[model samples]
Target: MRIFAFVGVFASVVSLIGCATGLTRAGSMIRESTDLSVRNRCEFIGTIDESERMGAGQGDNRRGALNRVRNRVAELGGDTFLIVSLDTDNSGAYVQAEVYGCGTVGSSASHAPATPAPSGREGSMTTGSGFYVSRSGHVLTNAHVVEQCREVRIPPTGTAEIVARDDASDLALLKNDIANQPIPAIFRGGRGVQPGAGVVVIGFPLQGIISSGPSVTTGIISSLAGPSNDRRLFQMTAPIHPGSSGGPVLDDAGNVVGVATAKLDPFVVARETGDIPQNISFAVSAGIARAFLDAEGVRYEILPSDPALPTENIATRARQFTLRIECRE
Candidate 1:
């Protein structure tokens, strides 16, 4: 199915761009609809708040931003949308829209669209985890986490820019706009990490469902390598959940040793091996992350292993640098 998207500008009226006047491939399916009757009949999906070229100070990237909102509407199984808000910020323009699912263009709606159950899910929003790598407010997370985002924010700090992304290594570096005295993670030199060593993972797992702060899971490095003998990863027994990607994995001394990445799917493993695996996850080695930061010219610190601290104490310190990553696409 093709997408038909057009969002009306609000009182501020930032963009002058309009919909295609004639039918094309993608243009024909999802067209501009100012008919309130059509909008009234459709069930409301949710609001899409997106920014274009945010924090870039170039002004007016509305066209690109609205296109992303349309794609997102289609992804949510919606067929039409109406711009509820469009305004300019200090750095860029943004649009907030309401997406709806009406039947075919000419036909009467057959069934009412099901609104997603309010089971604590961030509806039309995606959340992940990240940690500060430098005092300059540079953050490191999995590239996939921010690749699809139109606006990446670290809560009260506002918008962040994707300074660099490495799909090959599944790492991305983000530079936040405000330098609000952020706590940067101190990585332990790569030489000391070993199998069977105790590690702590600090992240926002399950986001809205769990406590607002970070969650701590403790485990040991199960192997020195990952699946298929990937040496850049550490196989660990710590739990990695949906919103836990890119979180910091710390050793007993409160030094970051790796970045939490993935966990095995129990059902998939069961289908392949006739058994279930539990607490089996992987994190990119901190050594690899450190190298990526260095290549990007980010000022991060790496110190030798220090005397071990209590697990709770390590978690308290690591939590300062660990943060929740909110992505709007």
Candidate 2:
């Protein structure tokens, strides 16, 4: 009886180790999205559904389900899988994906569209910033950045498709075709916006003029409203430049509270009002962004709150999802 009990315990440990190894390996090769464009070179490998046991923690359950989905795709000889949908029921967390095979070299080439040269009157290229919001490759940026653009490039990633846009809100969503998984922005839900909260901004400003890396700025949420008391906007003291549009306004907890949109034009405002506004910038509140995503039926992640992260750590994490948006008109 003692020998049998010891054997059972040892077997369970081995099984857990095997599962962890498989998940890590599978995660390294799989890419998730529903926006693959290279069907000509790849063959469909059928859809896969994966679910995992859930306890009190939804985060752990979701991660487990995603890992299972990736593992199943790898087992079926598929290099990429597009996440069709994810949901949770009373029983567990579940994810469904469509698998594809495009040969041993991988399907990255098939996923990207051919790059075209700049053309027409808006032929010049402009750069801005954006960040990923969903695991399905959905990115959020200012609509103007990609407006009338012939091609949108998210550097170190790949070409992106303009999936949705709201000119009124100055927000746009892009679907990228990259093999690497993106770290999504954590929206700060249930946390009310407060005056004088510490904030940070990350983006690629001035491109070649500055270093090729994203720049970081720190400040505080100066006001809860914007010009004319626009409650949908947050007036922050964080300095923003021309290229800073569409970047995220993150709280000390590293949760996104708003989307950097515009700043008071000192020249124009001063000419009209005879007063120069300094360090006056505005960002669309996270509530507005959440509503936009909801209207578009885009799924996103949210966190209740997080322990305050160090400035360096926050910047490092933000860089993972923050991308340089290049537009050729």
Candidate 3:
């Protein structure tokens, strides 16, 4: 039995070694470039992805992954390639490369790359935040977040479907077939949402720009009304950014009172008022949001309790339902 097991393990390693770098003589001649100038000179052939656990190292088998990709590019008759993305971990690695067929410009020394941007030249990929609204994986976010998105994703659970949206209210509901029953956010009606009440906002702000997850910001309700005295919205002092939209604003009792929607553009405001506004933000009141869900006939959870808890405890509970909302335009 032991001998058979050893033989099986050896065969697997051999197979991995052989698959890691299926380098052809032509593949050896392939060049890698992240320069936009070079990319412009070459025709965009296609994007290729290679995923496998071909090696093990602190570098995460990057060399082996590159060789395999080079082999694929050569096979596709592409002489140059630009890495679009490279993600790896202890289990395996995944690489996305854009193959380009360049003539002679790629050989020029002047086109040598100075640095690599996070990924290859691609379309805009914006990130925001959203929270589960039901056990069946219903999510809530700003309509503008996924407005023009060609594709919408909520990581781990994969792609999500936009169920219902009300542009006027700026709220959109998304549905995902999550593997596990999600712990939805507890919506506290906006009736008792008074100014000076402590609130916690959780979201993924500046997502791809900053390598981080859900962030927590604490503040007090500045006013019962929003810009132009919009009754449907509430004003708050919590700081938020471009990617903070759609995040849940929870009260001290850990019940969601609103959805973080917009932040005052300081630069634009500074130009007009000669003073930049500080922490000026707005959110769709939970009452308005809940009404929308009710109209859509989506079942959600709401608790009547207002048990005061530690801010950290509230954040931890919020994290369970909050997730990064990714949009590829």
RMSD of each: 16.1, 21.0, 19.6
lDDT of 2 by residue, 274-307 (tens): 6977887788889988898887788899887568
Candidate 2: where is the Cα deviation over 4 Å?
1-122
* Stretches of candidate 3 exceeding 4 Å from the true structure: 1-122, 189-191
Which 10 consecutive positions of candidate 1 have the poorest summed lDDT? 14-23
Candidate 2: give the clashing pairs. none
Work out the TM-score per prediction: 0.64, 0.62, 0.63
Scored by CA lDDT, what does every candidate get?
A: 0.69, 0.69, 0.71
Higher-scoring candidate on lDDT, 2 or 3 = 3
Identify the leading candidate in terms of TM-score: 1
* Predicted model with the maximum lDDT: 3
Q: What is the number of backbone collisions in each predicted candidate, taken in the order shown?
A: 1, 0, 0
Clashing pairs in 1: 4-30
Angstrom error at residue 57, model 2: 54
Residue 325 in model 1: lDDT? 81
Cα error, residue 4 of model 2, in Å, equals 66
